[model samples]
Target: MSLGRRSVVTLAAAVLLLGGCGGGGQEAGAGAGAKVTVEWWNIVTTEPLKSIWAEKVKEYQALHPGVVIKNVPIENEAYKARLTTLNQSGKTPDIFTTWGGGVLKQQVDAGLAKDVSDEVAPWIGTMTPASLQAYQFDGRTYAVPADIGMVGFWYNKALFAKAGITAPPTTWSGLLDDVGKLKAAGVTPIALAGKEKWPGHYYWAYLAMRIAGLDALEQAAADHEFGGPGFVEAGRRLKELVDLAPFQKGFLGASYNTPDGQAATMGNGKAAMELMGQWAPVVQKEAGKDLGDDLGFFPFPAVDGGKGLVTDAFGGGGGYAVGQDAPAEAVDFLKFLSQAGNHREAVASGAVLPVVKGAEDAVKDPNLAVVARTLASATGFQLYLDQAYPPAVGQEVNDSVAELIAGRKTPEQVAQAITATAKSE
Candidate 1:
């Protein structure tokens, strides 16, 4: 789902490499006067994380004189390629950013990630389980969860009024009716960056979760079969909205961060809403005119007879994992970084959505706070499928779902195509 960030990751031709605390040193000390270096690779190139992370590292290092923390903030796409190369070369950073889905699973499967289950157990209960969902596999944990968030509809309240939608719908049927009303009022009902197939896949993914339950998704991935009735039904529901032609003009090929893309369409009030993650408002403000107080948010509506609860959430967040060969100091540094007090400082930057329990109060943004609270109490949570499955299988889901959205495939066909890919993987 790009975590539904509108698929803005920039793929680079080459990876950025930086020299870290190395040179066959005995160790970068972590204990006072005991030098031990922890090479940490992360992708917080953007603020407030970029600045906030550096400050936290400094604080951690100050507390442990001999501990030198090397922070490397890499770009997203570059990180992926570079990490793949590192995995193939059988080397890993002491601590590195991870999403804890297919990629991390592969890394873990290949024995590249450290088993932090025991390390995290003592304080694990202090954090919300939903925030740690992606990092756990077969009752074992492999990473330290940092931030957690979900995806839903972000809409313009004024536009809703203009279209006579007194309130956001709470059911799938009501939502479809609202879409029809918006279209009847001649307003572009929705904004979608179809060029980024990940955005299109969210519709199918969420619907599947609502109808089949989160377990169904995990089961499908395990069984390498998406031919279940719930999978087909999810495609059908998505097709219902697509058939209504609810999206913006030329949305089929619209780029997300471009001047005239999905975020801009909603930000500029040319469209009523967009199905996106917590970062929706940020992108809206950046790419188009700010909607400010006029904007509102709501979870995806519940489907009738669905196995999933309305409180179920579908999303994931950026996290960090210890490498198989990283210095023990790396895990300690991560623990320091995730402390309630230290993590709360990041809330002020308005870039991160906190994962640590008791830090929700640090969130001052109204819309984001709503999301945070909802996630805190969510009855179930599912990480984005693309991030939760093998890379090949994940891409197949996106491609197949997009083809379904573009009117080029049927629900059954979509399910079959994805199943085929999963089996191949």
Candidate 2:
């Protein structure tokens, strides 16, 4: 998942990064009592986060008059492209947005990112552990999470009732049965953005999590071996759902947040459910009609005879990573941003989910509150595979899985493609 925004192929170019901090010096701390400018790059060109982040920056600056926070807000896809170019040239903004998975790991490996394990030590524990997983590597922290979320089913209650389904399914078989019911009732069972390959991968990823287990998925990524029985079975299971013709017409070419895309389809009530992250409802309201009280959420169903439990959540969130040589004040600003009081505003706006402990109450939406509760008790967690694996390997997972859904590839072939790419990487 893109966490809150739709991802694009341009992000794959992120693999080319090789850089260090771009502005300020080691002496650029507030204590120095000298003017220091820290360039902050982020994807917050949209509302809620856009305005909220600006306010936080203003607050941070007011507290340290000597420090000038140069905030650079860019659109999501454009930000990736710009970052890729900067990174390829051996330079990065002082403090930049990060997804904190394989992408951050690559920057860490290339000596581009700062290792803030000690810098953040004092208050790092104040964050939810699951939200910090993606940013940690080999016992070191690379970034600080500003928001966190998990992927699950967002459905329409009225549609379910119309289909004669009394409640959401908790098991794989039950889910398939519900799909049958929805289809028989003449409702599109699910909405998918096949044109945006990332959305389709959610199904395969969740299925692998349910059937093969979270550990298996992690081990496969680490071992560069995805052509295992468990993974293949995950693909086969997804194929079973695909065979049901569950998605709307033109789904294979549909976008994610466009007016006639996946979110719109579900928001308009043409489809009963969509497997999306915590950002679904907001995007639905933006791209189409808000389902209002008709909206509901549920955890992905558990697979029979599988190693994973329903409590194993899968998703990732936004965070900030300081460049290798950025000013210490840059790190301080990140801390200020993560503080419970400051972060709560973002959560309260319903623009982001809580990453820090004690901010959970900020999630006021009924459905979002359910997500927060689920995350609080999650037994295991997996960041989105596209962000967890190397850029090439992750793209392969999306591409191969999309092909499988399009009837252009078999489960075994999908696994083989991903395994080959992983090994090459």
Query: How many pairs of residues collide in model 1?
Result: 9
TM-score of each: 0.94, 0.93
**Model 1, poorest ten-residue lDDT window?**
1-10
TM-score (C-alpha) between model 2 and the true structure: 0.93
Best by TM-score: 1
Best by lDDT: 2
Cα lDDT for residue 46, model 2? 74
Alpha-carbon lDDT of model 1: 0.83
RMSD of each: 3.0, 2.9
Residue-by-residue lDDT tens digits, candidate 2, 109-134: 87888999999999999998888988
Clashing pairs in 2: none
Off by over 4 Å in 1: 1-34
- Looking at model 2, which ten-residue stretch has the lowest summed lDDT? 1-10
lDDT value, residue 408 of candidate 1: 96
